[model samples]
Target: MDRSSGGRDRILRPVIRQFDLKDLPAIVEIDREVGGGYSPELFMTFHEYHPQTMLVAEAAGGVVGIVIGFKHTPLEGRIFWLAVKPAHQGRGIGRSLLSAILRIFSRLGAVSATLEVRIGNRRAQSLYASMGFVVDNVIPSYYSDGEAALIMRKIL
Candidate 1:
């Protein structure tokens, strides 16, 4: 899908691509801006071990969103993190990043995908549901601040 917006005279479209080491700084900044709290080392680890599933959304020549996922088993893919720059939210960037990763997972032979979303994040839950994910379980105190998490799953 064409993930673009703005007036016709000045169209802005986000290009989804595989993550690179050079994108670390921008992605870290985005994670911070969105209060994702993930360490840079974690991003590097994902890039090192699962480059195909680690992707970034670039628009206006800068990274604006990121999705980190990996195949947990031959049949299962796990989405570890997803964050979009606050300034770029609601522009279809997050959805693009997610769809890209899920496609990668399926191509890698995964039969199902799963992710954990903070129970209070209704916006994310809504997006996941729209993409065919259903709540499969819930874990109490899943976050560092004591928030619970809903484990959502979707069949590939």
Candidate 2:
């Protein structure tokens, strides 16, 4: 959480900032880079339609990751997108992003945090599981590429 570092960048402050509509283009591209292939229209629509629940992560330079979710119901939150630049992966950026978003959800009185991950995305699955999310269901061919999605949930 050390945002002001002028040294080796060994200590990341792990910023959790509110995602702006302006960031959608980059986010959509990040999706594609991360193998999530989100359409531009869908990205714009989702962010514009749900600004209250979007979050982005940045470092000393600029935004390198994003995590989007929405209130599924008054008591539940659904994470739609989470992508970190490949160069930044395995550096705790994604985890900090999730932690930040989950805190916001908890403040909104959300009782659970849920998301669907493409079945083959073992890295993401492990991340979610580490965050206390458990697989509760599966939807066949849920992804555009026909990848099955595991519906995971964390009871907050």
Q: Pick the candidate with the highest lDDT.
A: 1
lDDT of 2 by residue, 124-151 (tens): 9999999999999999998777989999
- Per-candidate TM vs. native? 0.91, 0.85
Give the local distance difference test score of model 2.
0.82
Structure candidate 2, residue pairs in collision: 2-13
Per-residue lDDT of 1-156 in model 1, one digit per residue for the tens?
Answer: 233655453334789999999999999999889888889998999999999999999997799899999999999999999988887777777888888999999999999999999999998998899999999999999988999999999999
Error of 1 at 21 (Å): 0.8
lDDT values for all models? 0.89, 0.82
